[model samples]
Target: MQRRARTYLTGVALAVMLSGGLTACTGSPEDEGGEDTKAGSSGAPDSSAPPGRYRTLPEPCGAVDLSTLKKLLPDAEGAPQGSSTPGKGTASGDEESPYEGQPIATYDTDRRAGCRWKSTNSLATRNLTVDFERVVSYDPAVSDDEQAQLLYDERAGQAEIPTESEPPADEEGGEGGDPADEGGKSGSGGSGEDGGSEAADSGTDGKGGGEGGGDPGGEGEKSDSGGGSDASEEPGGEPSPSSDADLSPRTLDDIGDNAYIDDQLDTGDSGVHRDITLVFRSANVIATVTYDQWLTDKRRTPDSAELQEKARSVAEELAADFDDN
Candidate 1:
């Protein structure tokens, strides 16, 4: 009887201890999963970033159409191969057709590619190159587009082009009309919505008159004064030589997602040559078009406006093609 009683007491004590241990475990750290911040397979945030938009780049050799090539390069009587063109290689190879550009060599076509075309005429030697780059992000936390944006910004900075906020060549001194505007009688009245100067007398009418003063003529004189006398005209009205700031390298608003034009007139021993480069980015791809014109006459400078226009035209076409395909 004594032995059986001891056994029952021992069993009761063990049951009580187990009950207390279970109660403590219910409120322990392991049970509070909802409050836990630790990351596990299912609980961790995603590390993979979004993929780039472009999987492949366009054919660099065919980026510019034949019509554009003809417009940019010399049409006839190109200098013999291995001539004085700076970028043109002097390899003793067969003469290349101006219509077909030589493909830029690269080990990985998927990442980057480019092409070059050159032609020479009595007037000038023209060289055009087009390049394409596809950016891939190495970090899983950053998307390819973000990586591309960073790279493009760095290049733009390195180009040393003026910021958009900087005044153009035209506005460097005082902001006003160009010389062409000064020659006209526009100084007699405020900007005319009608050729008849309808607003000239309207200022007298309370409803349609000028905002502050009723005299529109005074407004014209103020604008003219702000611009000073025509910079293109001398004191005696002689046609003085003029330089416009529109030719300066500046950021473009509409070529691509982000774009800029770099205009440089190099007057070196080689000769006077103007280079206009247009660079733009779309999605994860970047495109660059470099148009070079080397004038045969060193005395005359290559027309910056003309080169910039041509480069912009090519860039627009390339961008449109990218959108279409």
Candidate 2:
């Protein structure tokens, strides 16, 4: 009986050891799963940051002041305000309405908006188009202002304007004659004077005086007249076209963060068309103003100074509106 009881006790101890080993093996997998879950949670990406600086855009048609619009499109002074609907016009056909402006086609109004005003009169035809773009930075590390500056630089590059406001060094050569040409003129003048004096000394004193005086006077007059005419006709004798200067984009100061003007003149069978584009960035918003004038007479072109003045005035008004908003 004692031997049987001892055997039963040994069997019970073996059962308890087996149960502990099974428990430890099963618990290891569960612990490992818990650790993996914690790691996954900690490795998740952060998505709580803000998305962009601007949440909304201003109304397209009402963005610019009415007075400014009238100044830009003089004929639109008495006309009604235009609709902001995309691809739809107040009139039945695509023809622009008398007083109402035209809405530019845009896929997204929240990100961009544009309006156009066109008027035809006996004196001239004028058209004004304005576009607004709201920039949003996706990079978490970049600020709105920095992103805006980058975008402005890109726009300026696209317009082919110099990054800075200064004119190029080559353009300065316009005012002064080339060094080589000046040197050649001086050499030729000296030779002519010397030849005239030599001829005078070889001839009779009285005849020499007359001949020398006549030769020098005639040569001096020809040279002076030729130089003056050439200088006036082609300053520096540079082949640079006047159109290049007119079309080249220029940077503007005292306007927004950065601003530039792009002027283009097109001559067509109908008449001369002048397009003046003024782009300025205020904070995160980019505003573009395009002023167009058409002259029926081919001989006459739109005044650039007047067009620029109108564009700048409109830009200032838009900037002020942005500030007010």
The best candidate by TM-score is 1
Once fitted onto the true fold, the runs of candidate 1 whose alpha carbons sit more than 4 angstroms away are 1-49, 76-97, 162-245
Candidate 1's residue-wise lDDT over 17-39, tens digit each? 99999988886866677456554
Q: Tell me how candidate 2 scores on lDDT.
A: 0.56
TM-score of each: 0.60, 0.54
Candidate 2: give the clashing pairs.
79-99
Q: Model 1, poorest ten-residue lDDT window?
A: 219-228
Question: lDDT score of model 1?
Answer: 0.58
lDDT of candidate 2 over 36-80, digit per residue (tens):
988887765343234544656766655565555655665554444
Query: What TM-score, to 2 decimals, does candidate 1 have?
Result: 0.60
**Candidate lDDT (C-alpha), each:** 0.58, 0.56
